[model samples]
Each structure stands twice: as C-alpha cells, then as structure tokens.
Target chain A: MFNLFDLGKIFEISSRSVKYVFILFIIVLTIGLTESLFLSPEDYKQSHSVRIMYVHVPAAWMALGIFAVIAFLSFGTFIFKNKNFSLISKSLAPSGFIFNIIALITGSIWGKPTWGTWWAWDARITSMLILALFYLMYLLSWRIITNKNSANKISSLIAIVGAINLPIIKFSVNWWNTLHQGPSLKIMGDTTIHSSMIIPLAIMTAAFALFSLLIFLMKFNTEMIRIKSKGLDRL
Target chain B: MVKKVKLRIAFLLALILSIILSLFLILQSLEKDVVFFLSPTDIKNLEEIEKKKIRVGGMVKDKSVSINSNKINFIVTDFKNEINVSYSGSVPNLFSENKGVVAEGFLQDRSYFKAVKILAKHDENYMPPEVKEALGDK
Candidate 1:
C-alpha cells in the first residue's frame, strides 16, 4: 500500500502550515497595498493607472505559476499512482482559475486606460485565454466524472497535457505578433521597471502567493472531508 | 495483478508517445502562425509581400514622423532596411521618433505598410526583447 496518500499525516502537516498563513497574509497585504498606494512613483506616461501593474502582474504570475504547480502535482499522481496528488491538484485548481480570471480582468482594466483598448487578439492574451480554458476544462473533468478512480486518472492526464500551454504563455509575446510587452524582468538582463515599482510588485506577488496557500489549505481540508465521507480507505 | 501492471505500462507509454507526436505536429503548424512579428529588415527581405496581415518592428526613424489630425505616417527602420507605415488612431504616449515600435497590419507593397495597431516601448530605455534580439550586437 502506497502511504503517500495517507490522509492523517497530510492533514497533520498542513494544519501546521495553516498557522503561518494568517500572519503571512497580513504582512502580504500591508507591504503591497501600502507601497503601491504610497511609495511607488507615478508613471510618467501611464500615471496612476500604472498602479494596476502591482496587482495585474502579480495575479498573472500566480495564474501561471499555480497551474504549473497543478500540473506538477498531477505528474506526481501518475508516478506514485496515489490519490493524494490528485486531491492536491484539485484543491489547487479553483485558486489558480480565480487568479487567471483576476489577471484577465485586471489586464483589461489596465488596457482600457493605457493600451487604448480593453481586448485584443494579441498572442499573449490569446494564449492566456487558452490557459484559462485549460484550467476550466481540468476542473470540469473532476466535476463531471463520477467514478473517483477514473476521474482522478483522466484529470491527471488532462492536467499534464494542458501544460503545453505553459511555455507558449511564457514565450507568446516573444514569439508572436503581440501588443503585450515582453517581461520587464529577465534572468540575464537588468529589470526594466523603476526600482521603486519593484518592491510593490514583489510584495503583491508574495501576497497573492500566500493567499493561494490559504485557499489551497482550505480546499485540501474539504477534500479530506470528502474522502472520509466516501470511505475509500476500506477498499 | 502483475499482468495488469505490464499492460498498464504499455498503454501509458503509448499514450505518452502519441501525445508527444501530436504536440510536435501542433507546434510545427503554430510555427507558421506565430511570427513574433518580423523586423523591418525581415519585411524588406521577403520575396513577395503577401496580402495576409503581418507585424513589423523597428525604430521610429528620427524626424520621419508626420502627424495629421487623424492619420499619422512614419518610417520604421531596423537601421538596415526601412518600411513606411501609415496609421490612423491615437498614437501611444511613448511613441516618438527613433524609439523602438512594433506595428501590425498589412503590407501595401514591399516599401509601405498600412498598420491597424501601433505599439511603443513601455518603460524608459526598455526595449522589447524581440527588438533587442533582432538588433544583434548593435
């Protein structure tokens, strides 16, 4: 028997992680919101609308990063053939999708004031939309499929397959006729944005990431309750 | 159970192979669709200017921009080749003469492009990675 999916052990550890979430979220909120509203300089061109970057960029990062995490967790399911990985993936899905929607909505809000249009068929936007659809479909598979074993197996496959969009989403602006600007941060080069802006953005990203952890734990607990009700341990 | 394990392994291996093959084919086709937009010099080097929409990126060619009330005209050059672009819209605030810009639309001919969208660099001295890469050692 595979012990990786042992529910009791997982819960014991996760509840410990939960203890830190509250304090982390408070810190997350204070740093980004305060800096964004106060310390950050106004864009010489975009002006105050530039503040949207503090939210939009971080949310988009969560959207992509969390989906990658889901896919990685799904891969673990296949390797270990354990239900725990699927549960984690399922728990992660809603938060990832929520962030994806936030990114798109914030992006459109930012676009209207800056890019002169709320929507475009630019490659980056198109790819991100596709990614959101992939997330939706992954969640739907888990909902629509009734058999626990088959549902878990199929959704794991879907999650892994959908990961094809990850690289595309990352490279779309670079590889296509996109109006979206390429990333300001690069591994090999200097950060393009003003140093004043980076702090707020980093804080926002950390806040969003912490918020995801809070949601993930709640969802994981729900999944645990679900597994107990189903009584799959007797199998 | 041992026999079931062997069968499952075979099935999964096949599934992974097929997925890999399909992804390769999809990306191969997407290769044609994702232009990442072309450089001005790439536009100039095209054998025949197709009717399909295309994107061109380059500097705004210092002093080549002409602003009218509605339509604006400018020259986009990669320092090697240039294409004259005509756009009808409010120009982006960062749009100036000599900064990097990418325009998307159709090529009227080899030397002229009619653009529907104009994108300018976002931050100060922040060049799009594509533009910087295309510019090479310069």
Candidate 2:
C-alpha cells in the first residue's frame, strides 16, 4: 500500500511553522523572564520569592496541556489507526516529560520558603508525581519495545490509560485539602492573582506553549525521516 | 469481521479491568497518605483523636498568640469554634494573629493541638478556600 500520508505537503507546513514558532518562542520567553525578574511587583508577603510563580505556573500548565494533547493524539491513533497519529504522539513524549520535570523542581523550590517544607504528600504533589511516571512509561515503551507496530499500539494505549491522571491532577487541590493553593485563576470566577503578575504569567505561558510546539515539530520531522528510510527498504 | 469484533471486545475488557485495578491501588495509597485538614468546628465534632497526623487550618484569633523562646502557642479559630495549638519550632513568616494558618500534627484533644510544623500562606489578602468556606463570613 505505499501510503505516504501526503509527505511533501506536511513537511513543508511543519518546517515553516517550526521556524516561525521557534523565533516567536525565543523572543517571547526572553521578555517574559525579564519582566518576571524585574518588572513584576514584589508580593507583600513572600516578596522576591513570590516571583517563582511565573516559572512554576507556566511549566505546570504546559505539562498538563501537553499530556492532554498526547491523549488526544493517542485517541486519534485508535480511531484512524493512522501511523501519523502514532508518530505525533511519540514525538510529544520528551517535551512533556521535560515540562513535568520543570514543574516538579520549581514547585519544590518554591514550596520550601512559602509552605515551610520542601514537599508534602498532598493530593496535588502526589498526583503530579504519578503524571511524571506516566510520561516516563510512555517514553520507555518506545525504546524498549523493538517492533514498531506493537510499540506504537502499546505506547498509544499507555497514553490513553494515563489520561486518567489528568483530571485528578487538575482538581487535586480542590477535591482534597492540600497545602498547594487553589488555582490562581478559576475557570468561572474572578482571578485572585494580581494583574501585574498575570501579565508576566500570560506571556510566560505563551512562550512555553510555543516552545512545546517547536520541539514537537522538530521531533516529528525526525520521525518522518525514519519512516521514509524504512519505506525505501520496502521499495 | 466477527473475529475482529471478538478481539476488540477482549482488548477493551482487559483495558477496563486493568484501569479499575490501578485506580483501586491509587485510591488506596491516597487514603493512606492523604492528610486532611479540619477546622476547629470539625475538631469539636470528632469523637476522638486518632493519633494519626492531621492538619488544622483557620484564622489565628487576635491576641490568642503568645511567643516564648522559640516555642509559640496560639488559638486557631473559625469564628464559631477554636483550638489551642502549641509549637516549639519557627513558624512561617506570615503566621500571626488574624492570618490564615495550617498546623500539622496530633490533636492532644478536642480543645488542644500540638503542631509539629506550621504553614502560613503568603497571600496577604487570601485565606485557604476551605478555611473561608468553613468560617463563612466570619
């Protein structure tokens, strides 16, 4: 079935988007960091330490968003059973894992001075660790399982099942009494965080989202190349 | 087509079963590790202290706090009820009267709590939502 899923057009689009987003990501991230460090108002209580929110919140948001994307892509794998969906899901794993790690590390660091402890077995922290495990499992399945078809199905299944953690992580603070504060911005209600902090936060979150897309495109390009080389063998 | 349908059923069955089993384990661990916070009223409502660690959060009642050589004593109240809390170590910078505080340790009784650690939030204008709901316009 020489099914090259519109190879030339996809390559052209991904390449162009990757270049555009990478430039945007760098410029936006620099501005976000500069403002976070210098321009944002010092919190009346934590003072300089409260600035950690700019880094921690955006990383946490990206971690959750990227995992949701993986689950969506995995769902696509099952319905379409298309190799392209599987490839995209696999491509997403590394960046998601890195973002998850960033969230955990920054969270721990931020917790020490504010919460008076480095970490606690609170619902929010525990659920996030489970998410990191899911990311690790999805990535490891790709490397350890030799057969490409079986690996694709297995990793997709892992992603699909691992989606169970997403909702738990989102509501962990609300559902249980945890030290981690309730979300700064509620879906419906007024934002509790100050607008000064929100500006840097919005900019930082955008930068992380763009960076995630750039990394996924780069990884997807490599996966496409691998497929093309293997297809050549069949010819 | 019948064979493919049977295979799909088997696959889905396995997936559902494993998910249920994993969920059971995750919840079991959560129960074991979950440290729930209770307000002063909940403390009054409890039959007895279980000796297992628990967290108590509320506003520190005004003038109910006393400091002495690294040891601090305070009353955490939800307007309608209160509990006396004692701690030997440092408290968070925000841990003062009229501020929101969460103390983790054993309850000596319904009226007395011994805190091993004290956590104070940095949000000057904020209280833990649970504390706010429990206190209710107090």
Candidate 3:
C-alpha cells in the first residue's frame, strides 16, 4: 500500500504518460480551435468579439480549478505529513499562475470591446484579481523560504487561507451588483447558452485541462528526477 | 506520530474556521460599499442624496432614446422606478433601447441625471442571429 504512494512509482507513471497526453492535447486543441474560430456562430450582439469567450472562460475555469486542487492537496499534506503532496502542489502552481494571468489579460481584452472599459472594480473582477495575488504570494513563498520543512508549512498555510477567496469569486456576480453578467452555465440550473456555442466551449475547456495536466506531469517528473539524482529515498 | 498528526490537522481546521468567520463578518459589513452600481430603486430608497459622482445602472427604456446634434437623452428604468439621463458624449455600441446600461454622472434631481459616460451591459445569454430569430427573441 505504501509503495503505491511512492515517489518513484508516481514519477514512472507520469513520465510514461506525458507523450500520450501531449499528442491528445494537440489533437483536441486543433479541433477546439477550428470549432471555436469557424464553426461556432458569431454572437447576435457581440459578433466576432464573443469568440474570446472560448479562451477566456476556459482559462478562468482552469485557474480556479487548479487553485482548488492546490488548496486540497495542501490540506492533505498537513494531515498526512506527506512531502509528495507538497511537491505535487508545487508542480501545479506554475500552470495555475500562468492560467490566472491569461484569464486576466484575455478578460481585459474582451472587456474593452464589449464592456466599453478595459477594467472595472466590479465584484467578480476584483475577486479574480485577489486570487491572482494569492497565487503570486504562494509562488513567492516557495522561493523566499530556504528551509524545506518551513517552506512547505508556510506555502500550505497560504493556500489554505487563499481557499477562502474561491467561493467569494464564484458567487461575486450573484452576491453583488456587478458590471459583469451572471453565469450562463450553471451546474444546478438551466444553461442559458445555446448548443452551438456550448460544444466549442466544452471542447476548448477539455483541451485546456489536458494541456495543464501535461504541464503538471512534466514538472512533477522533473522534481522526482531531481530528488532521485540527490539520492533521496522520499520527499 | 499519529497523535501529533491528528493535533496538527485539528489546529489547521480551527484556523480555517476562524478565518472564514472573520471574512464573512467583514464582507457583511462592507456589503453596500462593495456593490458596483445602484439600481433606480436602490437610489430612490436612499436616506440622503450626496452631491458626488455615482453610477446608476438599469435597462434603457424602450423607445425612450432621443438624439440631438450632440446630446442624447434616454430614460433608464428598473421597471419600478426610472431616471432620465442626458449625455453629450458618444455612447457605447451596445447602448440601445431595452438593453442594460450603466450611466456614470451626477443626479440633478429625483428624476433627472447628467451622465458623463455611458456603458452598455450585455446579459449572459449568447446565441447567433439565426437562433435568436428562430426563437423569435429580440
């Protein structure tokens, strides 16, 4: 049972799967791009500007999803005292941070043409900005701290604290009068988006998820190799 | 080792609970201030009017828009209450009758507004022209 959780085993599996994931990511990405760019009809109002949603929405979702995963793994690290958990969280952070920045930039670009402003201090927008800051602080904490145990503890604490902002971000539009619109796709409610738009959005989201997983596997394998080279049995 | 791990997990949970409580209280206290704009009803229910720059957001009343040489006049309504807004600058492309809008400016009186900027707010529903036509939605 313990061997199932061993770093070597994790590394072997990730390294083996990276190429397959990459090939699948490329295939999905090509289909997703073609669908979103050409097949998906332009918005009745926003027209071609609405195409930005394919990238912006998926990037935002991945950023939020990755951060949630990090926070959960950090909690697991504290309980199990598993260094592997922290290492996995560490590997996940860079992709999450990159996605966060991508979401913000793409959102700003989309906002300029649609909302008539590049940015606003709306509730949803502000909460997302705060989340990006949390990601930044989490990344910086790992770099600034020298001691291994202390670094893991501090970073985990930051992630746990930052988890508080996740619901705030999710509910910001509904909770307050924001310039941003309410969610079109709801898990428990009716989806306002049409099937034509939904198909591309779904495909693009899957492509992004696969891409992030590929990034995670590469980063995780590199960390494991580093540990093995140093002759450490476990993290 | 098990006892130590259990204690650590308990402490982390307590910390999370306390932090959540603090955040809830803070957000509750700052509720009104955090809102991006006030609806017409919200503005009407205010205790006292401040002579400050504020934003009023609502739908542009159907067929209430009138454009002059440079100035444009429109009525913004929340269906229960309405405020008449007049602006001199160009409005966003999305600004039109029966669409959501936010006007930033000063309130001249209970029923009048002087807008410095007009921002069109689109709803979450997205569909192509053909789908909209098929559904007979405007």
Candidate 4:
C-alpha cells in the first residue's frame, strides 16, 4: 500500500503545482476582492457594513471545511496506518487555524453595529469560539508532543473527538435562538440572499478555497523537503 | 505492528465514544439555558415568571413605538402574543418598527417589561437600497 503513495512523486507533483496555484489564487483573489468590496451592492439595511460578509462568511466556511477535511484525513491515518495522511493533516492545520481566527475577528467587527454588541455568548458565537479552541488544541498537540508516533495518535484522536462539535456548530442557530441571524444560504432549499450578492459571495468563497489550497501545497512541500533532507524514505 | 495498530484503534474508539457521551450529557443539561432569549409566546406560556433578569426576543410591532423624553417604549410581539418593553437607554441603529429585536431586562409582569438593553435583530435577507425602493417598500 505504501508503494501506492510515493513521497518523492507526491512531493514532485505538489511542488510543481505550487507556482500555478499561487498564480490562480492571485487572479481569483483580485476578482473576488473587486466583486465583494466594490461591485457588490450595499445591503439595504446594514448599508456598507454588510460587505464584511464577503470575507467573514468565506473565512468561516473555509475554517469549517478545512477542519472537516483534517478530521477525515486523521481518521484515514488510523484506519490505513498511513503517515502520509497525518502529514497532510498537519499541513492543513495552520491554514485552518488562520481562517478560524479570521472568521471570529471579522464576526466580532460585524457584530458591533448589527447585533449592538462586540461580543455575545450566543450559542452560534460560543460554539464557534469552542471550535477555535479545538483548532488551537489540535495545532498545539503537534508542537508539544516530542515523539512522532505519539503526536500522530494524539492529534488524530483530538480531531475525531472535536468533530462532534462540527454538527453542534452548524445547528446552533436552529437549536437555540441566538443573537446571530439564521443562515441565509440554505444548501437544500431556497436561498434568501439576492443573486447579485450571492455571485460575489460565491467568488469570494472560491478565492478563499484556492488560498487555503495554495497554503497547503506550500506547507506540504516544505515538510517533504525536510523529510528528504533528513534521509528518511517515509514519515 | 499489527498489535500496535489494533491498540491504537481501540484507544481511539474509546476516546471518541467517551467524548461524545460526555458532550451529549452536558448539552442535554444545558439545553434550556442555551437559548439566547425567550420569545414573547414562550414567556406567556411559562408557569412562573422569575424575578431574575431575562431576555425576550420578537419583532417590534409596527406603529407601536413611542418615546417620551429620554425613555423609549415599544411593543414586542411574536404575532400570537405581545409584551411592552420600556427602556431608558439608547437602542441599536437597526432597531425599528417591524424589525426583529431582543430586549434584556426584568419582566415587570406578563404584559410589561423593563429593559436595560435593546439589541436589534435583522433578518437574513440582503439587497441594495435601490432594489428595496424598486420593490415599492416605503
């Protein structure tokens, strides 16, 4: 099975794609910024402050999406006994953590004028805070643990356990009457948001996704380089 | 290697299961308290209204807001029920008639509330001012 995922081949492919991903990310980001910040119409009620949603919503979606990816990868590491899965999880964490913090901060800033408070212990807000803490714990486990195998075991365990909070975070608004408004864009049903705004939001989300992927590839390449320099065939 | 893998699997399963169990117990206990605020209807149905400060959320009834000097008075309604909220402080910019709002303060009675804070709650709909104007909203 190890023969299926050759580290050198994976490293070669990822390293080569980094430059192209970087270029694509820059192009998409510029378009996203223009659409979100300028082209997107001001919210009828919120006025200009609603532009922050372009960054805040995408950052939040990325944060949640990346964490879900990490959890699945971590689970794979255990079942397949694949160190590569752990390595991919490790590379994905920093970008996820960064987006999580971005989401929280942007949310706080948006909350001030809209919700009339900079911070509220509403279920949605508090659950997101807990998710950030869980991200911190997952990242810290890798840094604090000295043994590679132990770190892999502990971090994967942490991710799987923390995943229970994912559903909790998603349903927090519905389950509890929080200060945060209900979801505007429903996956299965009709969306309340106007298409003019939704187009920009979609572009921004794509740009953020590309940005996270760029970060993952760069970080993964660096890890591969480090392993190669250490004269190790596998993690 | 196989033994070590099995041990890791068992260990991981135990941790995941225990965490889920504990979280479930915690959330179950905290369920009632977890709601950010009660609706006007929720308050009306309560068996006993406590003296402790609480939050009630609902839409501000249209043409129901009144002001006298520095204090503001408004009626919060959940369509089925309504409560009069009186506050001495300023309200959020978004606070308006026919808009969602949450008031935190003491419930004076079943029909009256003395509020300390008024937080405006906006709905999820978003569009430009022009679009709203074109839609014939005055």
Top model by DockQ, which number? Answer: 3
Q: What is the lDDT of residue A102 in candidate 1?
A: 94
Model 1 chain A scores worst on lDDT over the 10 consecutive residues at A226-235
Worst 10 residues of 3 chain A by lDDT: A1-10
Q: How high a TM-score does candidate 3 get?
A: 0.96
Q: What DockQ does predicted model 2 obtain?
A: 0.30
Q: Best-fitting candidate, measured by lDDT?
A: 3
Candidate 4: where are CA atoms >4 Å away? Answer: A232-234, B1-14
Q: What lDDT does each candidate get?
A: 0.80, 0.81, 0.91, 0.90
Recovered native contacts, candidate 3: 0.79
What are the per-model DockQ values?
0.23, 0.30, 0.81, 0.75
Residue A42 in candidate 1 has what lDDT? 76
**Which 10 consecutive positions of candidate 1 chain B have the poorest summed lDDT?**
B123-132
Question: What lDDT tens digits, residue by residue, belong to model 1 across residues A122-205?
Answer: 778988999899999999998899887788788888888788779878977776656677778887888777677788888899
Ranking by DockQ: 3, 4, 2, 1
lDDT of 1 at B54: 81
Q: What's the candidate order when arranged by decreasing TM-score?
A: 3, 4, 2, 1
Writing each residue's lDDT as its tens digit, candidate 4 over A99-203 gives 999999999999889979888889988989988998999999988998888888889878887788898889898888989999998878988888899999999
| lDDT digits (tens) for residues A3-104 of candidate 3 | 357566777889999999999999999999999999999998899999999999999999999999999999887777777789889999999998999999
Q: lDDT tens digits, residues B10-81, model 4? A: 887888888889988988898768988999999998788869989999999999999999999999999999
lDDT of 2 by residue, A1-235 (tens): 2257677688778877888888899999999999889988777566788788888889988999889999888866654566667777788889989999999999999988887778877888988999999999999998999887778778888888888789888988777767777787888988877677789989999988888889999998877666677772121
Per-residue error at A92 for model 1, in Å? Answer: 0.9
